[model samples]
Target: MSEWRIYRGVREPHDGIDRLPDPPPWRDFELSGEVTPFDRHADALGDRRLPRADAYKAEERTIEAVNTALYLRRPLLVTGDPGVGKSTLAYAVARELKLGAVLRWSINSKTALRDGLYQYDSLGRLEDAGVARELRGPTNGGPQVGERGDVVAEDVAAAPASEEAHSTDLGRYLRLGPLGTALAPYALPRVLLIDEIDKSDIDLPNDLLDVFEEGMFEIPELSRVADKQSEVRVRPADHGARITVVHGTVRCHTFPFVVLTSNGEREFPPAFLRRCVRLHLPAVDDDERLRTIVRAHLPTAAEDADEVISKFLSHAASGELATDQLLNAVYLVSRTARDGAPSLDRLTALVFQHLNVTVPTES
Candidate 1:
């Protein structure tokens, strides 16, 4: 068995599942369900949980952890094997609660916490400023009525910036990533999917603590110019929309619903563990695995699907194969079943082979 990195932090287990309140009152949401969550995609859900959804059969412990995270306004750290639906948990919750779209921030070895927050385009803003200066041609006139209506005549080069020009504040040059978008103030809390957190740098998780705890952050550029500008409409993760931040401060009305997924490839720090509600996802029973396979791939699969599922289950017992591989085998078999059994026993040998497993040849 692989070594599970032991942490020094005290374990904070989830209490009963009913501890969660009926959605935080601080957030702005159209109440619908018993505990309706903030949904970004209200139109997509349309009074339904999820349109194209399959049941996520998680154990009671896992469900309890989700509820606990929601109640405490903390992030959930889910660790499990690859293709074990760790990332899918975020989508499931968002759908179940009728929350809007899931804001996902996929992490990698080089991913930094700041990248997920916001990006300021200083160079681009500088270019735009230069263009504005160029657009103002030489005009020397004062208090003249033009054909359009009452027009102020002045030297274009010497004239002050218009209201539109002033509207382009420091925040206009900013684009919030998924993390920043989730943290942005909204009527309802957004479901933030931090996928593959284990692949991030060692410091990324620790860096996120301040934001998680405070439920807000500041843009240094915006902060510097805050005295000059009281409110700045900045672009967030969503396009064609702007969020007003006063004094360059963006605070969450409701703490974002964060779901951090890990593949158990690496261990997180003790401090990081303490801040999160962690859940260890285990492999499901073979029958349930087959059901997932059918739900995803062969929804119309005939009774013969059991034979292919059994083959996958057999290999899964002895080797390291993901559930997706089983789904793949089932899809191929069911699609071509009309042509007769086309060497499924032989196909499983090649189709379900694990990357690290070595199978001996006929000797």
Candidate 2:
């Protein structure tokens, strides 16, 4: 895939945001193995997937919050209603940071730290082992091909193959869930987005607080085995490998680009909020919202853009429609237009149908 594009048009507004001082050469980062730290890569920090200025509605406040988090090296808490792009902020940060990977831990009632970081897929591993055994065993040399495939009794006795594959600490193969994938070592810093923290149970957030605070976790799978002290396999994010926990515990080897989002539907513990730099995203207005949809989904300027946008704006103004549904309507209308131009009536009908609002009748 092509490298992610960062639009210059979006970044021109924040032309004067002061950048942090360059780090010393001694602070360089090495993801696969420890290396000398250096400031040479400092300039590359904060290069994320989304342009810093793309968030046009809350340009100043958003940039300030992001810059603050970068400078303070703290977690940013983005709280807002759904579809307001709260989680997208993390993507913006990842783009700015120039980080190749972002660890996303989507929080829900069933979520746990273990679920986010790494959970071994036993089924996949078992399937792999079974296939390996079938491939490696016997090349049909049984009893000289059993005299033209007639005498199978002696062929069966040639070798008693074991059906059971050696059991692997299957969990050791714990594929880094989105969380673990983010933490996987990389030449660039990784963005770790813990989305919808409010959907999680009380204990889930509390559990994550510890890991984020410490900046690491133990991959008992990656640790030094008692017998294999010299053998250590550290998997890079691009490659799939399980971490083994050795002496002490596996801690966050590198501080991740962490962004935790919430819909603000539930309140978090004070201590939870204390560690994070919280930013509440207010609702975007009609004009700003329309512009956002235009920029995000209709970059080519579909002919029906204005009409679709106006309908959605009216719906939003009357509190009868959701921002996403509005965007979806525009998307479908634009996609179905025979020549990239939808008629006003068609656009209006789609809006009314999707938004579930009845049009007023003329008396």
Candidate 3:
């Protein structure tokens, strides 16, 4: 009857899905069965997994700026040195909002619009067309169609041509790129992690201005079909159209919690800067660093985690390595301890070996 994008059933195709913990309380919720609204995604902010800013020795102003931007639905442009948790903001927001995090679009010189959207397989399309012709050919006993009393060849040929029916809409099959998918109207608040935007070309940030402003794109390839044009809404993530054909107009959803991270490597155009809320993520101190380590690696004893964190931070302050690298080191060490795979003694050796930190040998 009506054209619709049917979401595949929630069947687990991998071991990870099978081993997933129970759905969080929010996941069980139903807002009139129409999917939860966007605002609901932010409701979990109060219970974010990270420790409160107060508990850490971090820049209170930076934390405040991030929170304010989230509450205000403004785009946050955070600039800092590499390895300084510039990208962690996205993860923190997702955890707080209870929505899953979509991360770093390692944008490079060649990355384009289609790279982020759903992939359209043209070869697959041709194969299907060939299969249809073979099956419906006269030798294969194709179905007969008739008006009232006679079997007409033209009627059979035109009988719901599946070969022609395959969608050619480049926009339709275009999977929502990370940024696009996050902005789509969904039951959840999407946390779009545009990591290392500084690495992107000069025109990339400027290019995004329109979509960031309007919140949507149209795919003519997918939406050119007469059947879809009349009925399908052309919404991303809906009806399997990752992109939409612009028969008319396209618009963006207003509140995606857009977060862009930069290493202060390049300056953005004024026009792009004006559209976003910019913040500087300053270096964190010992107390704050320890706090993050404890929060993420807790149940492994704060004292042990602190000891490792202290050493890494000491090295970072000396400019031996960057803060982001230290955080990564701590996370891995804590994970090592938590998983019961190693002792602090062994982890200390591994951390020094893998990270830039130095571990004083036994006396």
Write down the lDDT of every candidate, Cα atoms only.
Answer: 0.67, 0.54, 0.51
Which predicted model would earn the best TM-score? 1
lDDT of 2 at 214: 61
Please give the TM-score that candidate 1 achieves against the real structure: 0.77
Using Cα atoms with residue i matched to residue i, what is each candidate's TM-score against the true structure? 0.77, 0.64, 0.62
Q: Candidate 1: give its CA RMSD in angstroms.
A: 10.1
Off by over 4 Å in 1: 1-39, 42-53, 137-167, 292-297, 338-342, 355-363
Span of ten consecutive residues with least summed lDDT in model 1? 1-10
**lDDT of model 3 at residue 229?**
48
CA displacement after TM-score superposition, residue 247 of candidate 2 (Å): 3.8
Off by over 4 Å in 3: 1-59, 100-104, 138-157, 160-174, 226-228, 231-250, 298-301, 305-310, 323-363
Sorting all predicted structures by lDDT, with the top scorer first, yields 1, 2, 3
Residue range 131-224, candidate 3, lDDT tens digits: 6556555443342333332211222343245543442223332344566566555544466777778888777888888776666665443444
What would you estimate as the lDDT of candidate 1?
0.67
Q: How far is candidate 2 from the true structure (C-alpha RMSD, Å)?
A: 10.8
Question: What's the lDDT for candidate 3?
Answer: 0.51
